[model samples]
Target: MNRSLSIIMPALNMEHLVGEAIATTTRALQRAGLSDYEIIVLVNTSRDGSHDRTDEVVLDLAKKDSHIRPIINHHFKPFGLTYWQGVDLAQKENVMFIPSDDETIEDSMVGIFKDIGQVDLVVPYTVNKKARSFKRRFVSRAFVILCNTLFGLRLRYYNGTCVVPTKLIRKVPMRSGSFAYMVQVLVLLIKSGARYVEVPMGIKPTSATASFKIKSVIEAIHALARLFWDIHIKGVRIKIPF
Candidate 1:
């Protein structure tokens, strides 16, 4: 089995941390003995002065490292849309996107990368739930329960950065441009009979919780509704054995 992977790092107004994120991702891949990989750093349009700076950092890093591929977006898009764009641009056997917010620990990434060729999907779950605030934990738990209940499937988590086969993911249509996009993809793919393995991963503590924002919350609800309609009403599903 080919262990080649395409790592997508999506950054939105994260100029201060994007560079380190890329460095950390590179180190994790190397430590996992994965040299055949590409890091596609996506710098989405930002509200502040960080957009151009972030793009510059990615471009500079790309010059020194051939594995770094930079994608600079001029218009602002939701996180899911940006991530899906990067997925389409990947040229490797497997694909996964890590947030540029520096919340992913290097060791956690190495754990996922090391299991690259062993499974069709590497699903990572946070082991350190205390790293997040009580409010976030509550929301995250509720979200997971809702997804499991609605889909009639049991999954510990859905939003974590997951390593999935590029061809398999490409076969599923991207319906949500919001954070729930991952949820939609996972449900559809799993229903289509994709094999997956769950692994424990650590998350760095952060005070930021943008998913609670009003716009993000609305987008999430809309995404869930659309996903339910597509699956239950429209009968949207990926073909198995792709």
Candidate 2:
């Protein structure tokens, strides 16, 4: 069957919250006049018992709603590997990536995609409600500017849930070091010219998210390095806002 929508959830140790996330998506789609859709949730290798419980819920949903399919990836932990894997397996024209324990959409988000005609990617803008710290917002804003300046990405928020067209995504080269997979996709897709649109949405960091100070610094350095590398490859001067 030709699916119209495929929502990919890259899950790891989100057993406590995965069920609620999946249920919310299903309801949202239903309210959007979309009863026929596929939900692909990839359960990556996790240290907690989240896998077994999530597997059960996914299978149970799949039984009633044939549109739901649970993809189990035991080889890799929760990172870009599992994320890319989920994207690769998505078979619908419209693909939405929702983090297992992170943010989701509003009623307007449903209307946003329903209104999107031919855009390659639709980025949902994030409103952080969980972490009130200014440090998180600063890191996120700096990276967004760097990506746009270096890779020519016009997205307002790249980390939030994004709705993408499968055909357009297939044209972009997607190969990066396991540790730097997301940066690779961002670089290749923008350099090759992908048309993207942006929308606004709420965001909140889950308690399980790696929001530690050390991790934040490491992530910033890695993103900066990737930005410079892309600039070097293209031989262009990035006009950074800083």
Candidate 3:
């Protein structure tokens, strides 16, 4: 199948890494034989000392490659909101987000594109957990277990960048505005009986572990609680249109 993808790259203050992230993603897409693809580099507001270098990098890179489209958000938005902003502008058969931190390697991205049309969703789990610290791993595992218990589905990981049909994902109501957005998306898509395949991929070690930060964790927890309330309490279910 000839697959076209809209790669949504969320960049916060990753001026030093966003360029490489776009480069690797472009190379990976080419290697995967996907001639039709676009990279949406959505640069969110940054609090770092640098003066909007992230947006500068994205725009500079976009000038080099027409496949790269840059969107600079003046105000800060959480992960989920930033992600959906890209999705709303995506025009492709499938969509997935790649972080601008450049943690996910080139080959891992190729692995995802390899399974493009095989299923409705291409879920990836980290094969190399040692790349992360013990604390990060423990928190990840516990979160996965919690999601499984609450949703009654056994899955390896919920946070890995998963490829999904553009239409399908846009159809599902987004309830989480924090880092737990991916978890909410996965659970709702799976519960709605979307065909999916899990692939194990390796990630490069990175010192940037922002998701596990106290503020991020608290925000994620609050978002997760809201999701649980909508699903278990209010009985919200996605009606995926084929």
Q: Please, what is the whole-model Cα lDDT of each candidate in the order they appear?
A: 0.86, 0.62, 0.84
Predicted structure with the largest lDDT when compared to the true one: 1
Candidate 2 stretches greater than 4 Å from native: 1-3, 47-52, 128-133, 152-154, 177-193, 204-206, 212-242
How many Å off is the CA of 30 in candidate 2?
1.6
Residue range with the least summed lDDT across 10 consecutive positions in model 1: 45-54
Q: Cα lDDT for residue 239, model 2?
A: 23
Q: Over all chains combined, what TM-score does candidate 1 have?
A: 0.93
* Regions of model 1 farther than 4 Å from truth: 47-52
- Clash count, one per candidate: 0, 0, 0
| lDDT, candidate 3, 39-59, per-residue tens | 998888755433458887788
Task: Give lDDT tens digits, candidate 2, residues 1-242.
Answer: 22377788877766777777877777777776776568888877654533457666666767887777898765655365566666778877767777666356546457555644445556667755445356666766776786677656566766666665666555444333233454554455554455566677765555443444565457556755755665566443312111
lDDT of 1 by residue, 1-242 (tens): 86999988887777788888888888998899999999898888865534558888888889999998998888787788888888889999999988887889999999999999887789999999999999989999999999998888889999998998888888877557777988988988887788889999898898787457888889888888888888888988877563
The superposed Cα distance between candidate 1 and the true structure at residue 110, in angstroms, equals 1.3
Q: After superposition on all CA atoms, how large is the RMSD of candidate 2?
A: 5.5
TM-score of each: 0.93, 0.76, 0.92
Output the worst ten-in-a-row residue range by lDDT, candidate 3: 45-54
Candidate 3's C-alpha runs over 4 A off are: 47-52, 211-215
